[model samples]
Target chain A: MNASTLWIFLPILTGALLLFLRNQRWVAFVAGGLSFLLALTAWLLPIETTLALGSYAFKLSSTFEILGRRLILTTNEQPILTLIYGAAAFWFIASPSVDKAHRLAPLGLVQVGVLVAALAVEPFLYAALLIEVAVLLTTPLLLSGRDKPGRGLLRFITFQTLAMPFILFTGWLLRGIEADPGASALIRQAAILLATGFVFLLAVFPFHTWIPLLSEETSPYLTGFVLWVFPTSALLFATGFVDRYAWIRTAPQLPQILSTVGALMVAGGGLMAAFQNNLGRIMGYAVILETGFSLLTLSLLKTQGIDLFFLLFVPRLLALALWALCLDILRQNAASLSLQDVRGLARPWPFASVGLIFAHLSMAGLPALAGFPIRLAILEDLATVSLSVAAWAFIGSVGLLAAAVRTIAILVAAPAELAWEARESWPQRLFIILGGLALFGLGAFPQWVLPLLNRLPAIFEHLGG
Target chain B: MLLNWLAGVLILMAGIGLFVSRDWRWNLGAMALQYLAAFWLVHASWPLAASAVKLITGWMACAALGMTLASARTEPGKEHGWRDGGFFRLLAAVLAGLVAFILATRLSAWLGIAPPIAWGSLTLMAVGLLLIGITTQPLRVILGLLTLLAGFEITYAAIESSELVTAAQSVITLGLALTGAYLLVAAKEETPQ
Candidate 1:
């Protein structure tokens, strides 16, 4: 069997099959197990080679062709596959802990399958259509039973659909550019259209209105999964673009533009996140900040930007997952996530409190937390590029730090008569404690995830030095 | 060549219908007709069999959306009238058409596509975006999406006659219809405070 069939098609069919099975917990374990297994297979197997399994001998080819297009999963892509599936497994396995998370179990698997196909598809133009399909698939996961589709969902669909045409138009132009790179006007137009497409997909400033709106309208837990998966895949898709096109990767001004955009997201997301009253929206802002950080990392493409970009996944996933878990737990007890509603919550929800605090601190890149060292390195490198960009990055961290402090103050703002108690269920407490410690574990020992992130650069041939 | 002009004119008319109508039934009718116009233009470049996919898929989506709205308890929104700024809506459509007409010449030459096809795609794209920009209601927004894609498809069909791209675009068309139905029924629940 080919890698595409085994990883992409099989999981989709399996997900369709799992839809009939109504046991949420059972489905979570099964899907999570399969995800882990797929990840492990990627880690262990060498593509485009024949291996003998005692008595059976067969080849596991890397390319699967259909409709005259190829989905190629080579040895170079092993790390990315492992990263995607490993992270999927983590999200799935941990999903059983949060309310409204059951929706993610089966549909989430299908979504991941489509996203993986988007990443693997050749003639990268097709990736735009695949990504749009993947975005539509996520609508159900975001909606609760009988709930109206929110404004966020509509704008989300609109912006995403709008991006496809631009990218497709770019693809049409790229053929012209490839035939004659001297077509300067075509090249300029293509670059602008391509960047606009990615800007929409990335939810850069003007387009980010949907993030907080969706967060406010839906469960934080569900929003977290979409926030993490779609943008990460989009960024990877963009890196693939940079890798393939000689003119794009060699463009002199691209880095400065990326840096400026990254700085904008950092400052805007961070400063805005600090002033928000709704806890869920704060999570949304953190996502925006994280995306900004990613763009900043990517701007360093001239150096080790790609490597730094990959390192972000491990800490970001851990932080968002932990943060989302705590918020979901709090959501069960409080009427709403507004400051007035969650006031003095820590007295009864100590473990959730700790988990939430650690997560917030880590995202703010506080020293001794998981995000610290990497944030420090990126900022140092960014400063060498331009101190103004570095200053904006620093201001962003401080803004997030301010938000973290404000959140702590509210959680501990207990009435005098209120007393501390561990009111969280055992499962909630266990996961939080473990998740919290994992953040610390990765922080103290960067080696735990750095090696995996280090290998991700192999997937791109020319872009990341 | 005359048939292409008639098809382009029909496209702009259907777009005008979509631009001002709030009633789901009328909107669907306009959309189905828009697809027919698109099919006629595309058939000039692609095989009849390939061109028919756009027609069939577009009608199927309209039928699906129509069934949902017929069964759906609420109106698509308040019916459009002078109070809803009908004159302004017509003005917008006219402006959009004018812009499309202006661009069609350059696009036809640069992309080496037919003038009729370029005009058809560009006009639909402009009107579709106008529809999306004006509406927040789910069904109308989705209609706008379908309209935009139809516009893209007309030109795209002429440029790249790949069956794979055609199928993928058709699936996207259907996916938008299904999702639109989903959002319509989903309106039963109120927004959380």
Candidate 2:
């Protein structure tokens, strides 16, 4: 059996079947268990190699072909598969308690499965197509079919659709450039096309309006999952482009451009996040801020960057999941997530309040939490290149810190007569506490993730080298 | 040669009609005709079977969307006079078409494609974007998106012609329409009892 079929097709087929099961709890267990099993298999089984269980032996192939195109997931990519599916399991396992509609498990599974294909698909440009498919899959999940569609959702779909043509055209242009080396015009056009495509896909700076908008317009859990999955795949695809193309990798200004753009995104998302009143919008801006940091780490890949990029993922995902869960819980109990609406919410829901505060502070890179070490390391690397880049990134972090403080103060602002109580259900509290603890645990010992992260960059041959 | 010019004319008309009209039926019809013309133009380069799929897929998209809007509760598209930004929009659209005309020749030469193909692609794509930029309505945005993508596919088909890529683009087209149908029903103020 091909690993692609195991990792990609199997989950998609299962998700489709789960769609009809009609029981939310059953959907959660079946999907989550399957996701966890897939992650474990990817972690333990070496692809394209024979393995024996007692007297039985088998080999799982790394590549599969469909429609004359190849999907290959080598042993080097097993860690990434494990991480992606593990994250899927994280979201799915929590669905029964959080999602009443039963949509997240089945559709989320399908989207996750498709995103894995985006990472594994050969000729990498086809990844754009797969990403589009995933984005479309997410549209239905964004709405419960009872409410008016928000303009943010509409803009989100339009902008994502715009990206595919630019990327696909870049593929054709790149081939042209390859055939006619020294055709600088073709090379330049290709660069513009590829950059524009990514700008749209990554929701970079100016194109990022939809992030905060979508978060505020939809359920926090679904929007949070969309934010986490889409950009992670896009960034990896981008690194593929950089590693595969000599022109892009060899460009002396490439790192500078990346750092500058990264710094701007951090500054933009951070400064904007500081002023937002809605809890969901704050989560959105925080995501944008971390995505900026990811790019900063990405620019340094040839030096100490690739490892830093992968290291950023676990903490980032953990913080987002926790923050989203807290907001979701608050959303359920409160009138709205606005500052005034959720004020003094800590009186009844201390764990959720603490989870919310920790997740925000963790993303802000406060000392002793998950986001700090990688943030510090990236700044040091950026300073070596240019202090202004580091300064801009620092300023962005400070903005987020300010926002986190404001949130904490508001969450605790209650009258003395109010009594403290843990109103969160046991399952909700367990997920929130575990997520919060993972943030603290990962932050205090950064090396715990290094073994897995160290294996990830090899997925990009040139960058890893 | 005359037939190619006729195809180009039809593509331009379909794009402009969709760009200006508020009526969903008019938009879908123009888009449907636009896809047929696109197929005719691409037939100059691609296999008859491959290009024909574009026409079929595009029509199926129209049918899907048409059926949804047929059953869904939607307000009648009100006609606007010059006082309601209608004149300004008409003027703006002509300017957009002019820009496409000027750029179409250079794009044709640069990409080594036929002039008629370039003309149709740029016009449809530009007007599609204009449609998106102008309206907040779900149906309009999806129609605009379809036109924009149809333009892109025309140029892309001429360049790559890989059946897989073509099929993938078709899937996205149908997906967008189906998704649009969902959005329309969801956007309705009251669900049927």
Candidate 3:
């Protein structure tokens, strides 16, 4: 079988199988590990090159076609696939700790398969439909056997569905632009539609209210997975558009618009996170800030911008995973994640509290954490363009830092009589410890992964780095 | 031409019926009529088989939702006697439909779309938006979403008539129906009997 079929179809088939074995936790672990191995094989195995195993020799092609459409997973996409499946494995392995092994493992695998399909689909417009399907899949996960689906889930579905028509319409209009490159009216219309669609998809500014609500209402682990997968895939999809169309990437106003939107998301999300009393909402704001940073990177000199964009990927994933794990652990003890509810939780769950603090601090771009190096790089780049913009971005970081400090204070405010104790299971403690180390390792030795990150821009031929 | 106009009238009636009615049974009937009208409209662009599939899947969706609602021991808000700001909502829906019709006419004129297709699609979209915006009920919102998708599909079929697109649209319709059913059941479970 081709790599596309192996990577995409295998996980999908596994996910389907998982649905039947939902009650068995071991199935989730085995299936999740096997899916990760498949993704890794796709990443490492060279396509169109023969491999010999004892007396057999075979080559795995990169392209797979079904129903007149094509899915191609070129070598350049290996890094991205590796990242996606790696994160999936991390989340899946940790699912049992959050009491979501059954639902998240099965459905999450399918969600990843469809999202990867979104990126690989030929004609790309079909990606819009695929994205809607993925969003539909997420509804069940978000509801999670609750008696009633929350308004947040409804809003999430509504906003995501609304983006589909705009994107599909944009694709239709783009044909007009392709036919007449000099047709200013058509180009303008396409641009507006495309930007509006991404705005909704990325949840920029006014469209982002659902982020905090969903994060607050759903399990932190599930919310983290959704937040990570949706925006990352959407950003990658948007990048594909910029890479494919010269007019879109070369639009003089494009960089300015991206920067403006990015700045707003950063400022708005950061400031809101600073005052938030709920830990889940804080995670939500952190995601918004990260998205804002990613957008701002797009405004940089194309090559540098694209490179910096990929740089944010691993750090953000690590920080979010750590944060969600801590939240889930604390949730086992506290009735709610509100500041009032989790106050003095540090006494009973010291490691988890530390993980929470560090994760938040990392997202806030504290020095010696995963998010700091990338945030610094982006800020430096922004300074070259506009120092005022850089200053504003820095202020946003400070807002998040302030929130982290407040959280730390609350966690440490236990009575003198209270004694510290390790409440987390061994596996949970191991995940948290490993996540914390990853944050520090990536921060301290970013060069180790810089080579891989630098290759990310190569996925887009015209987007030089 | 006469059949096209008839299809348009059926679509308009369905949109208006969905707006004015509160009972699930009546809404289901309106939805079925809307899908049938959609089949007729889509027949102009797609194959007869494709159009038939649309109608069948839509009816299937309606059946799934109908069964879910029927199985519930209580109807949504049965005690209130349809006291869900019915008059204002209907008035708002009518106004929205009128505005949407005017906009669709202008849009079609600009895009050079045929009148029947544009009118039916825009009317459905406007009414769907009205329902989704005004109602907090999951069933109503889901119906609105399905209506919106129906409208989008009409316009989309004019541009791309691929079987794949049709199949995808059918999946979206069924998916929305299943989600609506899930939400309806969940709501039922939540209610203290």
Candidate 4:
């Protein structure tokens, strides 16, 4: 396998060994160290290059046949693949605290599975099998210990599994059209099926209860991995179908459909999150809302939309990584994830809480944080379309921002009790510096990042302040 | 020629018998009859090579049944009725007929005959989804899921056949069934007499 393939699989290969390692600390250190090296390698790989399925050799730029179909990898995919795997590696490394408590091996395996699934051709169809494997993998995680499998995991699996047949049948139907191009009826059927399958998989509105339940049941770090990696991978994989099927991308009604669904998700999930008592659930809803925003951007059907999708993805991943890390470190002290439990938490763990607030604000798309730019860009794009469209985008942005404000309000409410003194850990301080540098870097010099994020889609590029 | 149709009718009848019969033994008999019908159907269609594979799968299934029966027999005789609420049985029966009829119609359509859209497959799928959606009873839902799956198989078989992907999909279904069975077995083990 070339570096791109190797970059994704290396951690997975090490995860197996992690299971056998007696010293959890060493497993954490080694796995993290190796993953960082791999991430660096991934970052260095030439963008938009394809590694043929049969040939291991690096083809700087070539498209060859695989099983009677062409599998092409372009420079556009390089940043995406690098960002996902590299970010995952960083999160896995930063999450040493949780790695000690839960078996990291299985979660790592699932992460790899999701990556492979996303990287695979026809992720729309392939995702079903991958999701099944993830469910199977989750069963052991869900069933771990004397703790009964919670309603959340059960619900998550049930909803996920139900979506499976839709995807498979959609694939089956779509496969038929290759031979019978005149089968317009069949094409429409496949599109509806595919759309529903994705809607269910992404836990789009009405199917979103599972996200909170799962986040609550699983370790925060693992939950963060699911929230960030899985959906992003699915979305990336979905882009392939959008790119491949002219009917889906070019359909006149498709963008409107996506926008409507997205608006509903944002409004519903945001409102729900605004009222939730549980922090994890709130984060879950926020992520769901963000997913909605992403969908809204995607519906624009421009390269700018894709770029915004990519740009929004980066900060969300970073924020969730920090969020999961904070939860992992603090879950031991809190009776529950309710704001009350976290009231005085910041006092004891100032750095972690600061990280949480930063992440939350970024999640909220506040200014100087990563979320702000993307949200603004999406809004600007919406304005060009219609006043009502811009209004809806504004409402969604407000909801996300409101959620963040609530979290900050809760944290600051009982600052004396919640504020945690920073530990003297040099490594943690280093991480804080890195996170701050990133936040500030993205914030102050929005210009430099805008070029990178602007490469997204035109809709987002126009929104760059 | 008539034997195939006869076997199909017998399987449908057995499925109905499973619904009406309160006795667990009778229900088992219906399942057994259904299995036999499946065996006959396979024998009538594919050559011995494919038949051999089906036969092996059948024998393995029989082994599982034997184990289930032996376990039940080993238990102390309680005055429990043989009835299984007949919910799954009824559901399964309705679904099987619906699926079979749908499959027949679709197969005819694919062969250039304009047969109607058999509502049977749709019914089977609907009932299966209902069973799975509403209930937490693993075994009942499993039976429902199996019925639903059978409906899918019929529709799929009518359209096209890629034995590899089909086999792969079947393996997944079987895996789900096995997981459900394990859950049932584990639950049975958990409860005290």
Candidate 5:
């Protein structure tokens, strides 16, 4: 079997099997362990090399074809696959602790498979359809058990679906632009259409309203997973566009536009996050700011920018997973996530509250945290581009920092008689502590992740390399 | 060509009907008519089998949504109604449809699209978007989504007539219908007897 089957199809098949399993805890452990193994194999297995097992040599090819379309997982994409599946494992393993493993694990695995397909599908435009399918799959997960689908879910699907036509139409227009490179007007039109499509997909600026709202309405863990997977894939897809089109890559205004939008997202998200009373909304805003940081990173002219972009990935994933897990854990203890509801939760759920604070702080790019190195690199890059842009980005980080401080203050605020205790289960505490240590470890030693990130830019020949 | 024009007219009428009416029966009837009209128009571009699939799936979606709405409460206030600001909404939809028609005409002409399909597609999309924008009612929003998808499919059919695209579109239509049904049931559960 090819790597595509092993990494993409196998997980999906496993997920399907998981649906029949009656025990939720078993589903969580199986899904988590399976995903972790897949991620390990993807990361460690060398493509185009034959391995001898008990005198039987087997080779896993990178390309798999279906109905004349190709799902190609080139050696360059190994890091990405590793990231996706690894993050899935992290989320799934923590899911049983929150009582959401059954529904989220099975569907989450399927969603990852489809998202991987979105990245690997040939003709590329077909990815739009695949993304729509993923979006639909997520609907049940988002709205499950709720009396009615929230406005957040509706808007989420609506906006996401709306992007499909724009992307498909852009693909159609691109054919014309490719036919005649000198067709400047057509090129301009295609650029506008393509930018608009990515804008919607990336939820840049005004389109980003759904993020905070969905975070407020949905389960934080599920929202975090959806938020993480979709935007990562969308960013990669956008990179694909820049890689494929010479005109787009060379367009004079493109970098400036990306930087402007990125700056706006960071500032806007950060500013909004500071005033939020809800932990979920704060997480939502942090995601928005991170997306903004990614856009800014992509806007950088040098390969270092691409390196920094990939550099941000591991930490962001870890931080978000930790944040979401903490929120979910606290949610079990408190009736609501608002400041008033969760006030003094730290006295009972010390680990959860601390995890929440640290995760938020790490996401804010605080010193000696996983997010710090990359955020600093991005700001440095922006400094060369425009000092004001750098300042705005910094301001955004400060906003998140303020929110984190507020969270800590609110969580720690209680009567002097209140006693500190670890209310979370042993497993939950272990994961939280490990996750926290990972944040500090990655922040302290950036070299470990740098090699993996360095190889990511190699995937995009023209845009990054 | 005459049949195509007739299909366009039916689509336009149904598009308007979806926006103007709040009654589930009327909305479902209009949605089915819109899909039927869409099949007729799409048939001009796609294979007979593909067009039939679109028609069947669209009808199934309508049936699914209709059945769900029927089983739930059908009282005037239980679902969305044309009670307050109905005239204003209707007026807004008409104005949006007009603007969309004009813009689509210009766009299609510039892009060398056939007029009949373009008009139908633009009208449906405009009306659907207006409905989605104005209403919070799950059923109405869902119908509007269906209308918009119908318009998108018509436009896409003119450009690409692949079976894969058609199949995907069918699945999306059905998915939308199921989601609408899910929402309706959820709403029913939420409403206290």
Candidate 6:
């Protein structure tokens, strides 16, 4: 197989082989080395043409086909795929330093499965299936000694499963329209189901109760994987449908509806996040609010909007990865995720606390950091469409910013209490330094990053649909 | 015309029997009757030879009926009386019936056995969405999911059938159902009665 195809599946194949290697140290070293090389190659190599497995191939660098109907991956997909696999590499590198969790091999394999789902043409059902399998994979990781299952895994599985029929059926409805050419009735039906599935999967508003609940129970690493990879993959998958189907793209008021839903999620998630004292739950809210902003960008429906959508991934992946790393550190060091427990942690674990703050700022879309340029681009696009949409988009950013600021304030002002006296290992300290540097690097010179994102729209302009 | 009338009668009788009947055994009987009615309706439009797998799936509904009976507690006198049980059973049966009816109508249209109507697939989906949205009880939710699945299956018949998506969905449905049933049993055990 060619490099592009090989790059995509190599990590997956290595992960599978790791299961029977009978050498943990060798597996960790070799796996980390191989994943780093593959990610480097995927980043450096020129994009390939269609790479097919059987009857189906990843047709567009952005799209694929499922069954008989097309499941388009948009041109916006490449940067996101790069970011995802890149972060997966980072997580793998850090895995050795983190706690000894079982089933490392399968965990990496599941990560590959999620990446494949992201690249899958019909992400509708296959993505959800991958998510369910991911959840099952985590059961062994999350539930070690406990005989009774926690509500967290169940809630996660239920919510994920609940979204399945919505997606599958929506796809079915859209296919039905193609059967009897030029049926407006089927179009509207497909649109509604599509929107409903989006809401269900995104955990928009009322359907989002599972986020904080599942957040509380799952580990920082797995929780971060669920929040970032799965949901972001879903967003990428949804982008395919909007990009490919001109009917969806051309819908008169659909963009407005999407923006409105996104704005609501931002406002609602922010308010809830502000009330939550738990760090993990706050991270969940922060991610949700950011998701709102992503949707808002998608709603603008312009080249800039597409660019902003692609741009959003960079900061989010870096910030969430750093944040999850910090959480993993804090959980091991402090055994608590409360703001109160983390107070005065700056004195002892200055590197981690600073990393957390920077990550939070990046997530908040603060100026100069990773999230700012993208959010700014989205607002500019929105302004071009309508002043009111721009205002709504701004309103969404404010909530995210407010939540981040609140997290920062709490991290600083809480009464000093020594919860645990733990020293950071050399590896943890190195990760914190690296993470901080990356955040500062991205924040200081977003121009360098903007060009990378700039490539996304060009790709989309040519072949996204 | 006679076949349509027979299908309609069987469905209606099964629906009423499911809701009004007091005995648990009668619930199984009504569920079986409803499946039979649905099978006949599915058969009337798509010939059995062409749709053997689906026909066998219809037969497997009998196994689902048996499984449901096994799942229900045998307590003759519980807080939820025959009335409550009957209402739920009937509600599930009716939702399934509505799904079957929509499928039959669409299939008939597809086969040129009936005049094509506007929004045929749309109407079925709308009904399924309504059922799923309104239900909270596990049994009802499963029924709602089945309704939603049926709507999609009929829609798929009009489109390309992917053994890929179908096989994937079948495995998922089986696993989900087993998980749901396990959860129900666990919930029953956990609740302080």
Number of the predicted model whose DockQ against the real structure is largest: 2
lDDT string, candidate 6, B1-193, tens digits = 5664665566556545634454435544654565454445444445564334443453454356346446655332224555665567556646655565666666556534431211233333443454445534343344334434444444444443455555554445444445444444444433211
lDDT of 1: 0.87
**Which pairs clash (backbone N, Cα, C closer than 3 Å) in model 5?**
none
Place model 3 in a CAPRI quality band.
medium
Q: Can you list the residue pairs that collide in candidate 6?
A: A62-A73, A63-A73
DockQ for model 1 equals 0.73
Which 10 residues in a row give candidate 1 chain B its minimum summed lDDT? Answer: B184-193
C-alpha lDDT of all candidate models, in order: 0.87, 0.87, 0.85, 0.60, 0.84, 0.60
Candidate DockQ values, in order, are: 0.73, 0.74, 0.62, 0.18, 0.51, 0.17
Residues A1-465, candidate 3, lDDT per residue (tens digit)? 587787788888888888888464685686679767965775678777899999999988888877777888887777778778888998888888768788788889999998988878888888988898899898787775554777777878888888998899898888888898999988888989888888889998788988999988888888899999999999988888988999988988888888888898898889999999999999999899999998899888553747888889989999998998899888778999999999999989988999988899999999999998989989989998978778878888998999999898888888899998888888788888999998899889888787667667777778853
- After superposition, which runs of candidate 5 have C-alpha atoms over 4 Å from their true positions? A48-50, A303-305, B73-83, B190-193
Model 5 chain A TM-score equals 0.97
A1-465 per-residue lDDT for model 5 (tens digits):
697898888888988889899799999999999889988887899887899999899998988877657888888888788878888999898888888898889989988988888888778888888888888888777777554677878887778878888898888888888899899988888878778878888888788888988988878888988899888888888878888888888888878898899999999999999999998899999999999999888788553546777788899999999999899888777887888999999999999988888899999999999988888888887898889989999999999999998999999998899988787999889989999999999999988886677677767777555
Ten-residue region with minimum lDDT total, candidate 5 chain A: A301-310
Per-residue lDDT tens digits for candidate 2, residues A293-356, read 9889877866884788888899989999889888888888988889999999999999999999
Better of 1 and 2 by DockQ: 2
Q: lDDT by residue for model 6 over A8-100, one digit each (tens)?
A: 456666676776766555665666666666556555544446666688765324334445634443334455555566666676676666653
Candidates 4 and 6 compared: the better one by DockQ is 4
lDDT of 1 at A381: 94
> Residue A278 of model 2: what lDDT?
91
